[model samples]
Target chain A: MKNRLRVLRAEREWSQQDLADRLGVSRQSVNAIETGKYDPSLPLAFKFADVFEMPIEEIFLRD
Target chain B: MTTGHAKRRYHLRMAVAMAIYIASLFVADWLIEDRGVTGIAAVMLASVPGLCVAAIFWILARLVIEESDEFLRLLYIRQIIIATGIALTGASVWGFLELYMLVPHIDAYWWPVIWCLGTGVGGIYNKLTMGTSGNCT
Candidate 1:
């Protein structure tokens, strides 16, 4: 999956650690998801949507 | 609990298990070799270290279950798979060599040690390839 996580985080002036904290995940998980090394599960994707205050489609896209 | 807390507990449990394992080895050897313990009593004595080793692995298993981060959990499962592969392959190859009388016989207990060392190798691999050791630290 491709995601606008970096852009969104940048726009919000949030570091990866900040996003990770919001998502209750490790910073490494945020990095892996941002770098496209990993895809988030459905529940975690929902968490991302909740954290980003945007729809999952807005944050993540089909590759 | 948090992964950090879980890891701390894991370390503590592992330390206790290792101490017991070492002490059991010494006590078992003393009873069997010096005190001439035999039969069921000696067998029971020798099983203590193995049980401790099993408990150590059980603690690791609990860590995996306790880890909340999906990525970290995935990494841990991958590491375990890699470690299991290495340990089993090493043992199988060594078994063949022993069958052919090309290598000295080794105690069966060494396989768990190999598995433990393989986890270290897996950690190194995870660090190199995934940018994190996946150790939950």
Candidate 2:
């Protein structure tokens, strides 16, 4: 899955650790997800949506 | 359920189980070999270390279950799968070699020790492939 997580995080001026803290995950996890090395589960995707205050589709995109 | 809490619990439980495992191994050896224990008494004495090893496995399982982070959990799952594969393959090959008299016989207990080492190998694998070595650090 492709995501604009990096752009979204950057837009918010949040570091990976900042996003990770908001999402209750490790910075490594944020890095993995941002780099497309790992995909988030539905619950975690929901968490991303919640944290970014955007729909999951807006944060993540079909690739 | 947080990473820090889960890791702390895992480390504490693992430390206690390992301490018990070592102590039980020595005690069991002393009783069975030095004291010349026999029959059911010897069997019971010899099982303590094995039971402690089982406890260590239980502690690891609990860490997997209690971990809330999906990525960390995935890393642990990967580590366990790699460890299991290495341990089983090593034991099976060694068993065949022993059966064919191409190698010396080893105590079956060594398989679990190999499995423990394989977990370290798995962590290294994770570090190379996943950019993180899970929570064991």
Candidate 3:
């Protein structure tokens, strides 16, 4: 599962720590999400979409 | 920012618990050196520190409980299962070695057993599985 988290975060000038802080999770988690190492849960995925102000489809996609 | 039980507080408690466990272990050996298990004080000495360390994990368990996210819970559960499984397997292997090749019974020494098991769980297993398909929170 790939995600545009890194791209979105970069657009917002947010580091992995910044995104993790906003989402109340560890930076490792954010890194995992960004690198496609871990897939986010539905709720967390939605939250990420909400945080990025983009639709979930736009942020996340199957590879 | 660390969540749940504040990393600093968790580390402090863990350190205190470990310190108490080691100190109590020495005390238990000293007090029981002559009297052996018959001395009730030895039991108390050993038990106090064991409970302290158990309490530390208990607190950590509570922190784990506080997380509503299933992803986080699964991470913890996976770790615990690995830890417990490794511990049991190592203990069984030690028993086998003792019974078959060396002594007739397993030695009472626990620290070395725990250290080896801990190394397996913390180092080997962790390296093998980088957190079981963790879903990001």
- Using DockQ as the measure, the top candidate is 2
Q: Reference contacts recovered by each candidate, as fractions?
A: 0.50, 0.67, 0.11
Model 2 earns a TM-score of 0.95
Model 2 misplacement above 4 A? B135-137
Best by lDDT: 1
Interface RMSD values for the candidates, listed in order?
A: 1.0, 0.7, 3.7
TM-score of chain B of each: 0.94, 0.93, 0.61
Please say which candidate is ahead in TM-score: 1 or 3.
1
**TM-scores of the models, in the order given:** 0.94, 0.95, 0.73
List residue ranges in candidate 1 displaced over 4 A: none
* Residue A35 CA displacement from its true place in model 3, Å: 1.0
lDDT of 3 at A28: 62
The candidates, ranked best first by DockQ, are: 2, 1, 3
DockQ values of all predictions? 0.70, 0.82, 0.32
Residues B50-120 of candidate 3: C-alpha lDDT, one tens digit per residue: 68756655655654665554445556556556666676777788788887876566544563446335534
RMSD of each: 1.5, 1.3, 4.5
For model 2, how does the per-residue alpha-carbon lDDT over B1-137 read when each residue is reduced to its tens digit? 69889999999998888898889889888888898989999898888889888786787788889998889989988888888999999999999999999999999998988888888998999989889888452
Candidate 2: interface RMSD equals 0.7
Weakest lDDT window of 10 consecutive positions for candidate 3 chain B: B128-137
Q: DockQ for candidate 3, please give it.
A: 0.32
Candidate 2, residue B38: the lDDT equals 95
